[model samples]
Structures are given as structure tokens and as C-alpha cells.
Target: MGAWFTHLILQLAAILGSSLVTPTPLVRTDSGAQLERDWGQQVRLKHLYMEGNSRHLQINPDGHIDSSHAQNFYTLLEIKAVERGQVVIRGVNTDQYLCMDTEGNIFGSTTYREDDCNFNEEQLETFYNVYHSPRHKKVLSLSLEKRPYIPNRELPPLSMFLPRENELPMATYSRRSSERETNDTDPFGMRSGQQASPKLSRSSRG
Candidate 1:
């Protein structure tokens, strides 16, 4: 009985240790393939192209690719994020909307418009409110349009679907020492990096 109890205790300890050491499962696609990690944080679609005259396309991030009709116009594809932050979708001659969440629910659609540059601020605000909710939950949906002037076959590849490396809409600033060589003169007429030395000298004299 003593030996049996010792063996049971050892087994329990081993199980507990294994559980603690196990790692979380990495995110992956339906086919068990690994996706780009950086993208999961900021979802960006680089480009989307259509093969035929199809006016609409649906991207399912969790859907499987049909091997036999993989290239067909009706074929569905999953759009995964290549970066972090909120997913942004843009397209030529069309307006697009996205609905997705961290839980893997994603839906998108597009519609063509004559003035592609038009900005719908209200729609954008609503989108943000939904995506940035407290639950961090996302809905799956999209709205897009194809321009009437452009031929279906000649429509340019949708570059707006994917995020551009240079598309960040913000800027950053850096500090410069007074002694550093710069184009702009300081407002107070002190040379770059000279202010520190002058202050030090004055302090020593005092």
C-alpha cells in the first residue's frame, strides 16, 4: 500500500508539472498553417484582385480553400491581417467596410462609387465605436462599390485591401541638443548645445 500511494503521488506531480510547462497554441489558419504573427495585431490586406467579371468577392479568414476550383471566380478566400491595430480596408473606385473581432469573426463587402475619394466620417465613427467596444468584440461585415466608369475587366488590382508600409498617418518628433548643427536657429538666439555649457559656466562663477 505504501508503494502504491507513492506511485500515485509521483504521477500527480508529473501531470501538474507538465500542465504548467505547456505553451499556449499559436494562432493558425484552417489548414493548420502558421500565419504571420505581426499581422495578427494589425490586420492589413496588401492587394486583392479578381479573375473575371465578378463584381463581388467575399473573404473568409477561417474558410478553407477549394483545391479543385481554387482559381474560380466564386472561390472564397480568407483575408488575414499582416499587422496589428485596427484592420483598414481600401479599394480603387469603391467604398469598403469591415466587421471583425479578436475571436476570429470577420466579414467584409465593397461597393463601387464614382467619387472614390469621398470620406464618410459618420460611418467611420460608427465602425470605430463597434470595433473598440469594451468587450473587444468585432462583427463580420463589409460594404464596397465598383466605379461605373471603369471597365470590370480593366479595374486595377485592389491595393487598398492591404496596408502599405508607408501608410501610417502619423508623425513623430525628436529632441535636439543646442550644440547640434541644425538648420533652424533657436528662438532665444542660443546655438544648438551652447545653452548647457553657458549655464554650467554661470553656475561655477556664482
Candidate 2:
């Protein structure tokens, strides 16, 4: 009976042509969506340029988002794909995560909150992209007044951002320089002392 079973298994393997034990090949395609498709791959965005004022979106050391006149160190952002089509952005100079509120207010947070920090990057018709928060159901926008712009259901031009690639800056961010203690008892205050997002495999500090 054992010999008969072995012969049957061998016959099945022969008929299958070794496909049962062979692994399927993975084919990867590259395009403008490469950044979103490449999960865990980090990218340093030199200029998150918005067309409204022709200024770069800068995350200040105090965890505030503002428009800048030129490409500065504060405007340097390191973005990584957390999931397919979803990314978590961080300010390379301030050690803050780019976050958005339900009111469409964009800010930076020391602690990484998936609901606030994780954004679905949507590519627009103009070859630019707009970040949409699935949790808040709001889009990231910039006002001409250099303040937070509340976005309506209709995606405005202010929501579009052109990501241009350039060399990463050599300046390192000092966490100690901008450390602050705050309690998150309320829903608005999400700041905490976490080194990185729990979903990520490695430390985000680096």
C-alpha cells in the first residue's frame, strides 16, 4: 500500500509538471505611481510645491505647517509608503509627522497617528497629486494667506502639490531642540513620545 501511494504521488507530480512546488513569479511595474507602489521605500521630497502662492509647504519646528518662499531645510519631507496607495509623511528637519484634521487643517505631530498621519495620495489630472485623509474625509490644501485652508468636497487647485525630486539634504534633525511635553487627554492633542509608528517595522527616528 505504501509503494502504491508513492507511485500515485509521483504520477501526480509528473502530470502537474512541478507547478505545485514552484512559486509564482512577482512582476513589478514602474511609473509615476512608483512611490506609492513601493511600500517601505523612503523618499525625500525636496519641494512639496503648491501652485497657490508658488511657495513650498514647510513644516516648522513647532509642528506647524506654513508656506515658504523658497526650498529650505524645513521644507524637506521624508515620505514612506505605509500601505499600497497610503503614505505617512514626516518633516526631516523637525521630526514631525504630517497630519490633517477633520477641518482640513494640516499640521505636524510628534506622535504618529494612523487616522491623522496616514494619507491616501491621489494623482490628479494635471499630473500633480492631492492628499486625501480617509479618516477625516478631507483634502489637504493651502490658503493664499499662508494659513490652513479648509477644503470642500470639491478638490480645489490649492490641494494639488507637485513633488519634484532632488538630492537629500545633509543637515540632520535634532529632536532635543524641539522637544515638548503634552498630555493627550483630549482628542485634539495627539502628541506623545513614540519614536515611530507601530505599523512600521523599524524605528522612524532614523
lDDT of 1 at 11: 100
For candidate 1, write residues 86-189 as lDDT tens digits. 32333211222232233423333332111111121111211221122112222221223222211122222221222123221222101222233244422212
Give candidate 2's error at residue 95 in angstroms. 0.4
**lDDT of candidates 1 onward, in order:** 0.28, 0.65
For candidate 2, the 10 contiguous residues with the lowest summed lDDT are 180-189
Residues 1-206, model 2: lDDT tens digits: 99999999999989798766778787666554664434436444456888667878888887768878677778887666666777778777677888876566677777677777888876766777778787876777765212232433356557788876644445343343224323323211333333344532123322
* Winning candidate number (TM-score): 2
Model 1: ten consecutive residues of lowest lDDT: 114-123
Q: What are the RMSDs of all candidates, in order?
A: 20.8, 10.3
**lDDT (Cα, 0-100) at 178 in candidate 1:** 29
Clashes of each: 30, 0
What TM-score does each of the candidates earn?
0.18, 0.61
